[model samples]
Target: MMTSIESTPFKRLDAEGRLLKPAHKAETRRPGRFGFRGEIALTIDPPVTLEAAFATAEDGDAGLSFLAGSLSSYKQLPALVEALGAEVKADGKYFIYVSDLDRASRYQINMGGVPLYVLPIDDTSVYNELIDFLYLDKTKMKKFDTAEKLDVIADGAAKYDQAYEAISYEEGLKRL
Candidate 1:
């Protein structure tokens, strides 16, 4: 005769015998243009980790969808939103994250039909970081035109690297 060992409720052991906690269900937002939709949790923390930032971009079926720039450039977000007549909802799918709240700022933009979560990093480090993260060849980057470079960066980021914490568009502006 054998007796069954009752495990803790709502908890399970992984292959390595480590206890696994239940996954938290993030709040979902409504669909956006171009069939964009997914869970978007509100995060007050600034994105200090690449994983957090990249997770936002990975939401929905589109995979990685983001653009990055400096705080000065992020200032244009409101005007762009106004031009599009799109309201920035607190729980909206459009999320942005910055490296530093006091200095860095970021935003989101719907270019053509794709929703891009724009991130803000130090202007001085943007190019260097991109080059390193993408493992981009300087000679190739130079040879490529402006549009081509943008494509390369987008493709590379989508493939590799990912952020810290994310906040709403309005919240980001207020911090700025």
Candidate 2:
């Protein structure tokens, strides 16, 4: 049986590395096999288009799946923002879905405290993106264990320093 590792709790930080207080609180839920059942409560207003990218592994083998698309691609994005009484600053942010399984992952971009952009990112997408960005060999990476893979992910995440936040699946609906 494959062992599961405890993931770090989600934390929000500012650009200067200072921790930011959570603007919203999430509700707790019962844990599932891989982790909590991945679900979100907040419905995307004027649904945006999404395209599935790839999966990291097969079933029961720590699968990470990805979906990619932009909120700007949606025709209703502006109307949605206007409905929310928010401005379009165009400052994009990344919202990471933090499930212990890592398989159920999605990202979002916020404008003026409103999450207006989102895309799914699976483990395969992350790995592929990292290799291309870092100039790493895919064949060599196939030999990596879980810890090593996590390390590589961390390195890649640090390089961009984008405004990103991680949210647990259990708390996502309430918090978002």
Candidate 3:
């Protein structure tokens, strides 16, 4: 699976669960999961498209979703897609929810060589909200170096206690 295209240090993961390997600072990979001890939460952007959402939700192998219909079925999903009501990130048909921790051990089953990130929105739930991003280790996932900032980490902060190296698309080119 290794290749020259993935060897560049700038490549990295974006916040959309996609690979941007060779990505510079400020660039980010997408998140894969957001759950508690046995639960998770997810917040997808707008461009993913509704059909894509359904495809993501219906894909039996993705293992990221179970059977969420609303934001309140946390106790219903077997172990594929738990639902919650605390989320609020949807446009026309998109929605957010918490992963049922009890039934979330399936995420690792189909991750397909991607890294996962977890951020703390309230510190109390470090493994449930504010996902960092998922990507390939050296090629697609290791772009930002959030290890030197003091303000990037907010009140709750991520569990790592280090600042994420975030750079804007414009500033990223400077390093190239």
Candidate 4:
């Protein structure tokens, strides 16, 4: 059952597990299972406020506020969130976990007929930490693009020669 508003480009999906067709970037779409949209690592200026980021996701049409608590169960979450320890507000609330925001953005874009938008707050340290945590052991889950491949290559430089040697000449040439 497609709503009239879902006709918008960002809201379009070919099937249950297919990628949402955004207005731009038609070539980047790839079929994915488990409603895993994708993750974006934000870099901000001064004055960072992650809770505001969560609030933005919450205000999205997908009603992402509901997913906040469940995110505590995601992999790597306990350690990261627990490490926050006493840094959180007196209310003990924050958008420290990226999984919730990522999932919520996916939900809105794929199922709620909403455009994807995330406001980046200022705080490179937190942003860097989020990016690092989001992609931990991520190769086992998602395919990497050229830039990401470069990142992997850079991060795994020690294994580069071995990885290259493991591939046949023809395969290496094809990759090149």
Name the lDDT of candidate 2.
Answer: 0.30
Cα lDDT, all candidates: 0.37, 0.30, 0.22, 0.25
Per-residue lDDT tens digits of candidate 3, residues 17-54?
33212212221122222111111223343212111111
* Ordering by lDDT: 1, 2, 4, 3
> Largest lDDT belongs to which candidate?
1
Q: List the residue pairs that clash in candidate 2.
A: 64-123, 65-122, 66-121, 66-122, 67-120
* TM-score result, candidate 4: 0.18
Ranking by TM-score: 1, 2, 4, 3
lDDT assessment of candidate 1:
0.37
**What are the runs in model 1 whose C-alpha is more than 4 Å off?**
1-75, 84-116, 121-129, 132-135
Clashes of each: 10, 5, 41, 0
User: How does candidate 4 score on lDDT?
Assistant: 0.25
lDDT of 1 by residue, 1-176 (tens): 21111211101111222211212212112122111111122221431111221112222322224333322344555443432222222223333334554543334445444354566555445545566646988788888644355456545655753443445556655765
Higher-lDDT candidate among 1 and 2? 1
Find the 10 residues in a row with the least total lDDT in model 4: 51-60
lDDT of 2 by residue, 70-103 (tens): 2223333333344323111233222222222233
Q: After superposition, how far is residue 95 of candidate 2 from its true place, in Å?
A: 8.7
